[model samples]
Target: MVNIQKLRFFDCNCSVGRVAYPHLSDIPDVEGLLKEMGRAGIEEAMVYHTVARYGHPPAGNALLTEAIKNNPRLHPVWVLLPHHTGEMPHPGRLLPEMEKHHVGAARLYPGANYHNFSLSEWCSGELLGALEEAHIPLIVDMDTVSWEDVYKILDNHKQLPVITATCTYRNNRYIYPLLEKYDNLFVELSRFMGAGTIEDMVERFGSHHLLFGTNMPQYTGTAAVSLLTYSAIDRTAKQAIAGENLGNLLKEAWK
Candidate 1:
């Protein structure tokens, strides 16, 4: 009954600006992003903060949260720094706040922000535990870490479903085994290389585990949208990648 082909998108890996590279840190504003999404057929997007690029995770998350609060089409995803500040925000405190404010997911940028790969005892146990208990999906920037490191983190927390992002064309091969190995791992097709790459990933991994994403300002939304529009896959699979997969995931998380 869900019209997968006509379904809009919920981009899982977008960021707002930070102070680091003022010019380069320019992510599109919510209105601008919504307009772009409309043109590209995206209905909503789950975005996070880019302030980590400037070493200010809390501020960045605050900006993102406020932006999404004002836009019905935008959903906020808080960014947490378990390694940078040497203090993890209390998940018991934070998860309720996110729920109170309508935030849907938590994102980690380990490679971009230089966080330790191991999710062992030293990591932010409280935060991770709360997310698992709350059943909120965690989005990780796979572009920031190696496949080996990603696997290790996934192994530590098998219950949490992680949506991986900032994926480039070259990492397609590395992503396959992980997709096959973990039922909870999903890949966002953001910076994916070409049409061929998208088709191959969907063919091998099926459409259920691939979500549509556009890094936006860093890359054109149109280009990322076109990659899927032009792919040879069935309309159902394309629909799943575009938004259905992310929607189903959110429905389960919010349930």
Candidate 2:
């Protein structure tokens, strides 16, 4: 049996504040979020504000920055949009803001139901290029973007580290090919609950690209942590998926 405590999980997909559509378990404040993390033995988390997704990115980003200012364990993730619409600052201004606020990652909501923007090169090439050049990890949810768009983004920006968050077992076929092709691609473990799926992926592609995430407080951290606890992979690989891989990605962004 694996020792869960030794893994030191660092969640990569989390949010703070009341979402526009919130589950009963959603955590709306920093204190509650910290408490929940403590209960799950999660040492750190990269989080974005609900407002950043449901409201305005700048306001939500600012709110998240302030909320996590005193807490080193909670790193802020800023929601980004294509700058052409002027909904967000251009990449030049945005990148500096990220550095100033110590934001660790950037997220995109390009679905027709949400941000209503295209991820095509013609729309977001400048911002994508800047993120690629800076080595900042770009996170997108499979629900928020189509597999075709995901492929296009990965194909266009080979060096950009792109993490697909909230992935499910249904995504295996799509995710597998991407993993096989893109070394910079990563998968966040939240809703990725397929029996023996973790073991299978590790066996096939290795554990370096599998990241620990809870999707909290929309879901529980226990499920994701349990996946690692019972996984057949060796200790070192478990440790990497639990936290080391995410730490290394953030370190690269800071560099």
Q: What do the candidate models score in CA lDDT, each in turn?
A: 0.72, 0.88
* Span of 10 residues, lowest total lDDT, candidate 2: 1-10
| Residue 66 local lDDT, model 2 | 85
Predicted structure with the largest TM-score when compared to the true one: 2
lDDT of 1 by residue, 112-145 (tens): 3455444554655556666776778888776566
Tens digits of lDDT, candidate 2, 91-191: 99989988988888999998888788889999889989999988899999887888888899899999899999988878898999998998989999888
In model 1, residue pairs whose N, Cα or C atoms come closer than 3 Å (at least 3 residues apart or on different chains), thus clashing, are none
- Candidate 2 has an lDDT of 0.88
- TM per candidate comes to 0.85, 0.96
How much does candidate 2 score in TM-score? Answer: 0.96
Lowest-scoring 10 consecutive residues by lDDT in candidate 1?
18-27
Off by over 4 Å in 1: 1-7, 22-28, 83-88, 112-118
- Once fitted onto the true fold, the runs of candidate 2 whose alpha carbons sit more than 4 angstroms away are 1-5
